[model samples]
Target chain A: MSVIAFAKNWNGKFKNSTFELVSYTKALANQLNTNMVVLSIGEVAEEELKLLGNYGADKVLTVSNPQLNTLTSRAYADIVAKAANSVEAEVIVLSDNNSGKAIAPRVSVKLKAGHVAAVQELPLSLDPFVVKKSVFSGKAFGHIQIKSDKKILTIAKNCFGLVANPCDVAIEEFALDIDTNLFKVKIIQEEEQKDKVILSDADIVVSAGRGMRSPENWTPVEELAEVLGAATACSRPVSDEGWRGHEEHVGQTGKVIAPNLYIAAGISGAIQHVAGISRSKCIVAINTDPEAPIFSVADYGIVGDVMDVLPRLTKALRNSKS
Target chain B: MKILVCISNVPDTTTKVKFKEGDSLFDDSGVQWIINPWDELALTRAMELKEDAGNSVNEICVIHVGGASADATLRKALAIGADKAVRIDACPADAYHVAGQIAEYLKENPFDIILSGIESSDYNGSSVGAMIAEFMDYPGISSVTSVNLDDDDIQINRAIPGGKQVLKTEAPFVAVVQKGIATEPRIPSMRGIMMARKKPLEVKPAVELEVLTESIKFELPQEKGACKMIDSESAEQLVELLKNEAKVL
Candidate 1:
């Protein structure tokens, strides 16, 4: 029996969050005095599989199937469950991102294992198998306990930083029966941003809100992000209004981001928006309203229009460097 | 084209969360209950799709797994243009049990399209929709922001990490919707509210399923320290602070 950390495959590569998943899974395996195994599907290079060892994974298992090049929730879940069963995994860990959210529940159901999502910390205790997770959209924390013999967990992305405990990983190939018919949900169109800094992986983020007013006004926001080498993001309303893409949305209804520095401009900081970004190491809010709720949580606040603050900040950043 | 929208009643986002019974239960005194905002997005989009598809779309049924406390929310969904409503007469224990009840109901009355919020506002467990799809052996899409029905197939645009993907799937599928599905949720008109009261809200008994997880305790996150107010005129100083004091640069 081992602690299994399922690596998320996206756009034909492992998501960067896999490191964080392995880091926490290693901690759990250490607590349980067991091995940490890294599981992935589809074809992956040997060097990519070996990278799991840098994060303390003892073994790497891959299911190289051409059929799994595109994600189908049911089939992906089946393969993961089979891998867990093969190892007699005591616990399965996955990052609670897009693919994980779709697959974790089905994997839990297949294994009849108790599952928890958006876990923030390592296990407080394992005798009863207690883990802490965000509840009520990050307003509070719930210490959840799994009553079943098997456990499946989805760690909230970026909260637990990766810790390296390098080991000589033993690699092996695992096979599962694939039903081609299950791939009914066809991904007819997909566009990957190969060069842009992903919001979840960025250390610094410049997020705009409705205060940007129009999509045309996003130039300074993008300029500021470029100046700082940060990723660009927006509040839920901004994304809903089509001012920005939904993938750039950061809020309870969208993506939860925990960056080293999060700068919010013109965002009122609704509880839902704050839920996603409250984990930032330092938050700077720029808004016209002095009483905006975002100021309450911000480490620093600048009372001004986002339109005004953004350009000045960008100019200052540009001038300071030159 | 029968469509089902799943609704979850949650406390208002502004509500200060409280725990009781040795931190084992939620404290609900004087709390305002509202439809899960994301679920409202799902309900509104389903209604719009039904309206757009016209007579081809047969009905829109809203479902929930809760007792009387959720009736008002279900009624709100009906008022927003759901043709009918179904309330499973039990409190949902967890995502799995809730998915089981919905799947059991769908087993008898399968809808062409099942829509739910990507995650519930309270627990934020994004499992029920996928679990339901798995239980029913149907195609499921998550974080879906756009949906269009063409004959028996549904074209869905779902959010990925750096972009969105357009997926094509046949009917008898499930979609977990998020913010971009609709700009603003529909508000119930006076006539709609009046009609909603008479709409069928069939209360069905919940299926028996063992809850796999239990909440041992709940606690509020630590309060943040006071914000340091920076003069709006001193934007350059703030940049300097970021570089030197905060060291985020």
Candidate 2:
């Protein structure tokens, strides 16, 4: 009859996505009126888990072991499942992020819990654990109910705002008998894309596409992001040509994003790309093709060659900043 | 290198997204279907692994969990050179249900390698592969960008927060393939297309897992305001408009 959340750890430093996730989950905790426990797995420090109090966690449940440093599907899932069972938690939440996406269902299956992914809102009903989630690539919302003893949820990024609290909570570390052999796969090293914003977490995003013509012309798009402090994204076709990294691709086939503002330049918004980002609060489309599908959904649409339009816009933003 | 790749039939990337009239059901009127674009990456990578293994790669089997519409996608995989295909002839609404069907099928025939798309473009749930891997008790890695097999061991280049990680595992594992891993998925050659005609395609009914969620309604987002134009003469004017008008930054 309690709620618990898992806060993500990226390297030694906290990831912005993790903080956003914790902040948002607190909203759900407040609505439920249940004790909230925030847990950080593996060797993440005790002090780190305590930070969850500010994000709405009533208590911090941490398990520290050197063996937990490398994340394996089996090991991580085992720890999470064990913790939930021991605590008899009614609800469990995690970021609908890389590791969470991979392990959430497995944990749900183990707990015999009803699971919901891509959640954008708190529950309208506590019993049956009914919650609202975006489905069909954000084309609609599905009301999901958990028909089991526990419910698992993967909350979408930036969907809920985090509110900071002043109270501090103490951390309680648990000893887990983890079996590393169960993890059939092992990671040697992880490499991240540079000069790009993660589409899933970007608050304001600027995207380009084949309309930019080639990789050489991507500078203007990058410049706009720099000035706006926005993330860089692309249409599927751009990623196909290697003009941009795969991480930047935003479409039904790449990533689903719901940023505060999405600025698409030199990109003809395909239906698939639109499906992915249509949930953005505001979209500004800049393209030379007046009839581009992008204009159909844009808050502000401009018909002009990006080669000329982007430079002017970048210059405008820079001059304004100075 | 016995490879297993999962595929889903999805609306073509360019297909307009609109639900059926008066309901949350998808509108199929003008919607053309294709192999989920993401699944194409998984299928191609599996075929490549089977090629590299040669004799060691006994077979490359394709699997699908859907209604009859999924058959076309399975044949498309066969056209791309999979030796055989399976269709769990049930329409699934949840990841757990679909994963259950695929997992049950795999239990009968253990594969050395399981490949799947990072996410299905239609539902875009992105959870089936991991559930299948867990059900079958195999090591699983999702969103793998590049893969290489050396001496019965697989090395994966995985996308991560700061950079990509190099992951290594033995055969009998699972990976959800992502885009940008290969050139456009190879269209089946005419010969392969012809041979696909004779390949084995087994169809089984989908398992019934209890439905957990129901759709109340599908609402299209609110329309945006019309475009505001800025004359191109002065950058200062454009900046003034952005700062004072659009207020995006």
Candidate 3:
């Protein structure tokens, strides 16, 4: 039996999340007394593929079919199932990102494997194969037991940090018959956002809320983010008011982020809003009302008008950096 | 073309979550129920599509796999302008079971378009839509922000890692929608509420399926320490604290 880790890459390069996934898979493999195999789809350089070795991957299987360039969930699931069957994999692991969320369920359906998404930690007991995950938008936790023999799981981002365990990795090319009928959805256009820190991957995030007063008063928030080399986010009200793009909204219905440091200004902490960022390691809240709900979960609190506090904080950070 | 929107009954967003029964069951004493936020947006977008004269969407139906307590939530969907509602009478055991029941129902009653939220606010599983699509062998598009019909063709825009991608697909597909599918969820009007009373809300028996996962325990996150308050006049001190004390800088 083996553990399969699905590694995702962009433009032929692995991201930090891929390293974390490999590390988690390696640890799980050790617990199961099995080897770990990392699966790579589409085109990635051989040199780039070898990097998985640094994270304790015993073997790397690359499927470089040009037809698999674009992400078709059905086709991807089929390929992953075939890889699992070839290696006799007992567990399949993936990151709980957009692609993983879309594909893991389909893979589970194909393999008849019991699946769990956004799993937080390793198995609490190997006998019953129980794992823990956040539920109710982070308000509560649920310990779920996978009853089926075959298991599929998607790890929440940032929950498991990267651990390097260098090994001699065997790289192999995996070839599978293509079914052209699976490619039903056609891509009409693609647009990539350029030159900004992606919020989900940022280490630090500076976010504002209605306390910034208006859309034009966003200069201080943006300046602070620029100085810190962090991403800019907003509360739902700010996005609903059209002060920021919907993508910048960080809350229950918006993007859920787990940055190392999260700074909130002028935003009253609503439960829904806090649910999204509750995973942040450290949170600093700046609000005029000292009794704001955000302060309860915050590590640090400053009571002041945001318009007055933001500029001063930005200046202080900028000066310290210089 | 008929459009089917899947909805889940969940606690209101503002309700404080608590579990009872030795942390094995959710306490529902004072909690208010509402349609899952993402599913509400999906239903709102469906109503918008049906309102347009150019589109062939003549009927919009909403479906839920839950017990009878969720009938009110289904009625709320009808009040929001869904023409029909279907409730598979059973406890939603898990994502797999819920998806299987819906897929079994769909085998006999098919629709051109099926829309489900990315995840239910309660479990946040984000699996049922794609699983349903897989069970039925239909194309499933996730993270969808917009769905439009242009002269009998469907166009969808979905959010990707750094940007967005636009795709085109035919009918008999599942689109797991998220925010931006509609600017705001529609509030039920007085007339709409009265009409919803007469709309068909069919209750069907759930198909037997094996439950794959079980929740053995529930836990609330540990309480955070009291916030370290800093004087407003000493804004620089906050930065120093972050650098030296918190060590996050």
Which candidate achieves the best lDDT against the true structure?
A: 3
- lDDT string for model 3 (B136-174, tens) is 999999899999998779999999876899999988999
* lDDT of model 2 at position B219: 53
- Give each prediction's DockQ, rounded to 2 decimals: 0.73, 0.55, 0.82
Q: How would you order the candidates by DockQ, starting with the best?
A: 3, 1, 2
For the second chain of model 2, what is the TM-score against the true structure's chain B?
0.93
Ranking by TM-score: 3, 1, 2
Lowest summed lDDT across 10 adjacent residues in model 1 chain A is found at A8-17
**Fnat of all models, as shown:** 0.86, 0.60, 0.81
Candidate 3's residue-wise lDDT over A1-322, tens digit each?
9999999887778899999999999999999999899999989888899899999987999998877877888888889989998999999999999889999999888888888899998888888999988899888889999998899999999989999999888999998897877888999999987888999889899999999989999998988899888999999999998889888999999989899899999999999999999999899999999889999999999999988888888889878888
RMSD of each: 2.0, 2.5, 1.1
lDDT of 3 at A259: 91
Question: On residues A1-322, what C-alpha lDDT tens digit does candidate 2 reach at each position?
Answer: 6777877676544565676677766666677776667778767755666566666566777777766666676778888888887777788888888888887878876776767788887786876477777766765566666666678888887777677764677788867777858866676765566666666667799899888988998888888888888888899888877888777888777778888788888778877788889878778888887889898888776678888888888887777778
lDDT of 1 by residue, B1-249 (tens): 899988899998777788999888889999899899888988888877877743368799999999898899899898999999999998898898899899999999989999989888798888999888988988889889898877666789987767779999888999988878987889999999999999999999987898999888998889999998998888789988888888988
Which runs of model 3 end up more than 4 angstroms from their true locations? Answer: none
Clashing residue pairs found in predicted model 1:
none
Instruction: Indicate the docking level reached by candidate 1.
Output: medium
lDDT of 1 at B63: 92
The reply for model 2, stretches above 4 Å from the true place, is A193-199, B20-24, B53-55, B206-208, B214-216, B233-248
